[model samples]
Target: MSAGLLVAVLLASALLEGSGWAGGVGDGNLRLSVTVNGRADSDVRPPEVRVGTWVVKRYRLLNVSEADLHRVRVLDPGAPAGSVRCPAVLPAAEEAECTARFRAVAGRHVHPVRAEGDVPALRTRLTATARAGYAGVAGALGLTEEVVVATPGTGGGGASAIVTYTVTNRGNLPLYTVRVEDPGLALAPGAPDCGGRGGTVAVLAPDTSAFCRTTVRLRPGTYRSAGRASGSDRATTLGTGGERVTAPVLTAGASAVFVVREAPVAPVPRTPAPGAPAAGSSAGAAGASAGAGAAPAPGAPGALARTDTGTGTGTGTGTDAAGRPAAPAAPGAGAAPGAVPPGAVPPGAVPPSSVSPGAVPPAPPPGLRRAAGVDDEGFLGRVRRRGREAAEFGVATTLLLLLIPAAVAAALLGSRRK
Candidate 1:
């Protein structure tokens, strides 16, 4: 063969292989058998299906060829055909099986499926059918409210009350104009959807939903509100659709209690105006006696100094050597020069008069003197006493524990004698 002819043959073979056709097209070669729910011609057809329900179709591929089959695949009507279960290589006199699954669409319709593959050098094709039906559109709506009371001192800004309503398409068919309505809030005219697009949705798939949010400024009181949703069910015949059937209006409501309290008041500090005279001075005193004046500014040194100076004026108390006011003395009281005050003793000094009548006094030659009624042994004596007490407690505890068994034995003996 010429080189060009050989290349043409190779291209044809590649196309056939890519298409996954294995056996010859005519009968007496590879055969194809299709079944729906395991019955080719049954009294009952496949049951009706809603959106999202599965429509299952099984396919069996048998190889009449004496050699193994390769490049085998099952093709269905829809893109991404469901799942296939078959061995790559089909030995002679044996068969391989696969399943094609289709998810129900929004309306009644028929879906066609087929399989094609190459056994060895020949091409083969098999066919099957699947049907899906819808049960009309129905829906349910629910509304919920979330309320948060503002904390004291946090006057405003955050959302205090929020109402959310969900519109769900519970029917088998797709829905249109899915929107929520609220008596308390301003919704878009002609029923506005949650997306706030101001236009109806072309299609809301079955078992799906949309959420509408409305916010309100809640005062310090209880709140109650109601909302509802509306939508139109889609109707389709054959391959055409878009006919709308009005669905029943769904109503829901929510109630929330929002509370707010008055903010707290903080005391303001008083500041003396600039050029104002110092407090508690003659000017401050004059201002006070006039029945109109602010109190002395707190923590001012001048105010404290004025108060201390005022304590000595017009009083009979004399000033001490330290310049502090002295305590008043009795009428006949007299003191020698450099003498300490009565009833006051120098620290760590012993007074002669404080000694007991018959106690022997220490000689003056010794710098240190022994005090009466002082315990010489002191801390050591206390420690020895504590140690003796601890030993007695240990002995008592040991005796008690040792006598318990003896007491029990004696009780048994007494009972036996009885």
Candidate 2:
């Protein structure tokens, strides 16, 4: 029962439960209680509801007598019309209950309820009170909040960015099943298990908070992230954050390239005809001089050498065993002047016994002049000059050709003397 009804019952029992009614007897007393809307009718402070609300009151009667009660009846005549229910017969030592309700009008009012019955040689009357009023209930439910956001962690190029959100419930009531969200940060397969993502919080009491961390993979471009908290309401904005991404760089080292072009070729020196002057000899000097006269002598600076191969006896002299001319031998390389090792001939002569009587020595090839040292280019130069002159004179300019030849011959004879 309501506090009002319980209070009303206690008050009625304290006031009238012990009063003796007839014949000095203590066994036939009446006890009564009254309540309104399950609350004690005698409560000093009853909960007030607006007008037109029903005010239901109930009255209970206990016989408390030695013998049976007859023709029992309960009444609340002080209540509004059509608002009473009384029991017709209630036995002695037994209890009975009745109820009444009235549409509350705009006023402060008090109502009295009563019970009456007859016991053997005793008559009885019981009474209680119910109070009600038309007043309004007043109170308010208000909510306020705050949010904190953590800076996002660095995400390497082509990697995921991570952000954290802390949502605080600064409301008067506890918030249940708190959740967090980020519009720009999509939920990913590998999002961290950091408390508030897809998870729930049992309670976020007033002035308390929770954290939600999320990780997402981002492509190579600048992006923005916005954070918020949600539960019973749509969503309260926590804060906003940002993330950026970039690409990679590569480099190559040294390299090479090639180009092609033709180069001028130096004229190769031609071998002199066999009769051309020995290299570095006066014939080459004379030829060189004939072009300008008074040329420097044989063996002059810058003269090139001609190589020679012989020992007078063309067969065994400078020939190797296979009969090829041996490379020019240095001095002191063969047997000493007069000391023949074996099967050797002396230099400068052939034994008459080995020669046929009428046989003539073979003439040396045309340009094969002997010299201590030779000039290959000088010999070539002399041959070139003779050719140029012969071309110039032919048989008509014989004197010019004759003079140059005679001059070259003289120079050759002079070089032989030296």
Candidate 3:
């Protein structure tokens, strides 16, 4: 091999051995030079030396400038990237400082290896968030909600309004099943369905979403609605949200609340039988006549308001007993906080308060230890050792810094004569 090629091979071999990559390094030697700002700092320095099975290069640096030279990095292009920190602070008239060099490491296998101290030209960063919820689907294939409302109909008891519920998974993580907790909400044909199998979704993977619907029955008075879910029949409540004036859930855990209201039936107007007066016919007529007798007599329920025995619906704009549009019902509990009033859960109703306020995850693993580090310098300027490597590598690298400038000079001077 040519001098350059031989030098490369020897250096590579020495490194592998030193790193324990090889069992032993046979004797080998080759030399190279060092330059800083175009000035040759080290004359023919040993370019490559095999200690065992690996190769390495030894060179030095002499910071003779007036200012404190700070590059905090080893200028190695063919190495696993490394950093260099000058401790001597190169005082204006101080002698040269020193450092040595090694060839490379397996880190080169990683794409665009930055190898510490060696800053890369390109860098990237990322962030993410995750949440698990009841209404959300996990890996489910086909589950759906079918809102079915039963209400007071146009003339009698029936569906007053058609409320559609669309349950969906809009966050990361999957949900296996969405239990029915709302008193009135329910999953049709067996908890809606995920594919053909009901229960939770099969896989509500990250970024995956599913939608289901359920109908709600509404009545005259204001009522709240809320529900809780469970993964299994015995599982405690997993999540909760709902509205007010709602009925208590039948079961303690994973039950839904539905509301039912019946308009007070009014007594119908009665005309006396053609020949015989009905039981209260005479009394009813007398009361009406008496109320009109004076300026609608001081009091008496707006003239006993002929209680319309008919189903009394707040006509048109659905107003209230006072003829005012019932102020929109407070949002139901857990209905998208802030948007819907929380549904009321009886004292012993909601799933036994599933989660406690204070809970924390476990600590990290050994492999996830903090990066190798140095601690606060003490009063004497001695760096506090972080761990084992700090003690060994820290000292070795320090000595190399001290020997750099001298070895470099000797190597160059010796080379000139050759």
Candidate 4:
């Protein structure tokens, strides 16, 4: 062949090799096809999807040549690693499939899928590519609101309550300019903290929540309050110029019921009741009168004059009929001190003038003795008498012990001297 003709032939052969068609005779080849959202690429229109929705991509690979394909791989940039499922080896004249998934975003999206394999019999590589397209639209706007109230305990005047509002985005799109409002109550200062700048929650993403808290004063009664949350799908301001756009507002509401009670009162104390005179004064007056008027029976105790009945004359010196000094009266007895009643002085009784004023009174006759601890000497007086006697006995015993030792020493000295 001529040199010019040979150059042209070589150029044609290079192009065929670069295009994977040089050794097309009996060499293995792969055909790749892709679908987006279950719609094939040859369809007239692409699949329409909502933003944040799942976009499913399917890849089909066919071994068109007479030889089997080995070490096959399917790759998609939009899908995560190990998410594309495909067989490692594909038989001749057979088809293999792969599936991958990704989330859709606002605007049109194009995804390219690639299939590659090794042809061992021909010692060559085969590659094929296909693309799928989908269009994304704006999602629905939705919201949910919840209100919680913390009521105060019993208090004076009206007490403050802590009100919390929880707003949640329940749809696939983000919400903007979220705010809470209550018509029946006024919020306190430095309140409505929604974890945003200036106590406002500007945005809430899909399926997420934001909390706002405020304070309000409530009286002592049952209160029912409702709170509404409103948000829009687009931001109110678009650019640096502060241009405002009107968007559809979505609202949700919830109500809370709570009660506040009143404080309790204290009680007052009572006064005591009235009654009688003391025993000492009545007994002394009765004793003086009875000493002059009557005497008790010989072996019987005297009956006390009734002071409450006003029957006795409470006057006169405390002396017996024979002019002897009287014995002291017992408390509450009201009897004459030492006077004997008419038949009380026995026939042979001693004369009063014979006994001195300071002399001790005679003991009662045999069967009329007083009980133990009931003597005329008071309990404190008896205690004093016993204490003096104990002191004297102790002193005498100590002197005797000293004298006995001295006597024994003196006796020993005298014996030695003799």
TM-score of each: 0.29, 0.25, 0.23, 0.37
The positional error of residue 289 in candidate 3, measured at the CA in angstroms, is 19
lDDT of each: 0.50, 0.49, 0.34, 0.64
In the range 1-418, model 1's lDDT, one tens digit per residue, is 6999999988997675555443233334344554543443211343333334354545667766554556666655432344655456665567877765555554434335454445444444332333322221233334454444545444333334555565666665566666566665454453433575542344577677666665555445444555655565533221112223233444445554445444455567778899776655877668567744443333222222111221333444766668877665432124332333344433455444566779876553322333321235488876886799899999999999999989999999999999
Clash count in backbone of candidate 2: 17
Candidate order by lDDT, highest to lowest? 4, 1, 2, 3
Model 4 lDDT per residue over 100-125, tens place: 77776666666676788887756677
CA error at residue 23 for candidate 1, angstroms:
12
RMSD of each: 29.8, 30.9, 56.8, 15.1
Off by over 4 Å in 2: 1-28, 120-418
Worst 10 residues of 1 by lDDT: 236-245
Clashes of each: 8, 17, 81, 3
Ranking under TM-score, best-scoring first?
4, 1, 2, 3
Per-residue lDDT tens digits of candidate 2, residues 89-180?
Answer: 66666788877766644334554455666654434443333333222221111222222232324432344455655656544345555545
TM-score of 4: 0.37
**Model 3 off-target regions past 4 Å?**
1-167, 170-199, 203-208, 212-222, 229-261, 264-272, 275-418
Worst 10 residues of 3 by lDDT: 110-119
